[model samples]
Target: MKCISWNVNGIRAVLKKDFVEILYALDADIFCIQETKAQPDQIEVDCELYPYQYINSAQKKGYSGTMIFCKEEPLSIRYGMNMEEHDTEGRVITLEYPEYYVVTVYTPNSGDGLKRLDYRMEWDKAFSAYLKSLDKPVMACGDFNVANEEIDIKNPKTNHKNAGFTDEERNSFKENLLAYFVDTYRSLYPEKVEYSWWSYRFKAREKNAGWRIDYWLVSPELKDKIVDAKILTDIYGSDHCPVQLDIEV
Candidate 1:
């Protein structure tokens, strides 16, 4: 099966940009979107065919949010981890299938100047614990918001102090993924420098000043089932591109 994840930046804007066309182009069996930034009533898309959908929206209006659309019904659905500190942002959603748990997450950014670095770390720890507790096999995908390694970012030296490239944040990211799952992209195409996210200003996208902060991570047991994990770096309707994983589900 094919699963794709994208952070549309803002659902309303991308909708007008013909996100539905992009969605059709992808033709993924399942699609998860981050930063939807819209309540269901705010924006409408053709739903007769791609009808299976689940949304976890932030309590605050027009802020962080996520949604998943699938080809078929899920065995069960969960909105979040049920942690007050984590659920409020509406950054997580899990859909259980007969095979494994498919989770889509939008991790919190540490913010510029390290203002929220401490908070981000707390969130990282909690999120890691939650994933580990799943125990069952998992295929977790999303905008992690952290460039895990020097190879994951465009200019590592320049971005060292940036919110997503800090050493501390990278370490936390490693501890989390290394604990159980592997970054499928790195495992399959380690030397590739393609990126999924770029800044709107400063010609970041044009110059390829981007970061591979988005990912598809799978449990060790399912590692061999992964066929490919890639970034659709050229699809530019949003600041972030779509990332995907082809797995033997």
Candidate 2:
């Protein structure tokens, strides 16, 4: 089955930009999105095929949030990491399918110049622990907000001091990938120079100056099942492209 993930940036905003058309084109078995920034009541998507709709929207308006639109119904669903503070921002939505679990996240951005770096580090710890606790194989996918390595970004040396490429942030992000499971994109095509998010500044998309901050992380148990992984770099909307994976059990 195909499991897809994207940071839509804003549900309300992307609709005008052909969000549904993109979703239909993907035609994934399960569709997950981050940075929706809106509640279900606040928006509407017309899709008869994928009847299951789940969302974890921030209590605050026009802020961080996530959602999963799936064709297959999950046996169970959960929101947040069981932490009150973390739930407020609506960052995580866990769907327990019969075969595997899917955790979609909109990991907090550390802000320019590492302004919110401390808070982001705390989130990393909490979020990583939450994923490990599941133990059940998971497809933890969405906007991770930190480019994993030098290959994941265009100009690594110049970006070292930047928010998404800083030593501290990169280390924090790197540690979790090591502890948890496999990074699907990096595993399947290690040599591919790809990116999932681009900056709005300086025609980053045009120059192809980007970061592989978004991901599709699979549990170690499912490592062998990952058939294909891709960053939909050619697709566009919200300055972030969709990352997709096809898994064969």
Candidate 3:
């Protein structure tokens, strides 16, 4: 199956762009989206291909949210980590199939001056535990927010202390998620440099100064089934481009 994940930044805004067209062109079996920034009632995706659509919207209007569009119906669907504090943001959505569970998350960013770093660390721990509790293997994807290694970001030296590239976040990501999951893109292309997210400031995209924050992480057991993993840098609509994972589940 071909699964694609993208942080659209804002669903309503991206809809005005070429979101529908791009969505059709990609033609993924399961398309996961993050940072929807809209309520369930406000999200109207005009695509007919995906009959089974699920959205997890935040309690607060126009904030962090996630959505999944699937061509095939899942056996079950779950929203959030089931933790009250973490569930409020609509950051996580899990779709359980016969073979495996697919989860998409919009991990909270450490705000200016790392104000939310403590909360982010707590979230990482809780979210990792949630994944471990799943009965089957998992294919988790979305804007993870943290750049795992120096090669994952363009200016690692300058960004080491920044939100996504901070030492604390990186170590937590490695210990929590990477301990059990395989980062498909990095696993396949260790030396190839590419990025999925670019800062809107300073013509970052134009200059190709970006970070590979978005990812498709699968359980270690599913690593061999990975056909291909790609960062669709050509696609435009959001600050973060879509990351694709073609795997046999």
Q: Pick the candidate with the highest lDDT.
A: 3
Task: Give candidate 1's total backbone clashes.
Answer: 0
* Candidates sorted by lDDT, best first: 3, 1, 2
Q: Model 3 over residues 7-29: C-alpha lDDT tens digits?
A: 99999999999899988999999
Per-model CA lDDT versus the true structure = 0.89, 0.88, 0.96
The segments of candidate 3 whose C-alpha lies over 4 angstroms from its true place after superposition are none
> What tens digits encode model 1's per-residue C-alpha lDDT throughout 48-127?
44789888888889999999999889889999897888899889999888879999999999887899899888988888
Cα lDDT of model 3 overall? Answer: 0.96
Shift of residue 87 alpha carbon in model 1, Å? 0.6
Q: How many clashes in each structure?
A: 0, 0, 0
* Superposed Cα deviation of residue 168, candidate 2 (Å): 1.0
Question: With candidate 1 superimposed using the best TM-score fit, by how many Å does residue 39's alpha carbon deviate from the native?
Answer: 1.8
TM-score of 3: 0.99
The TM-score leader among the candidates is 3
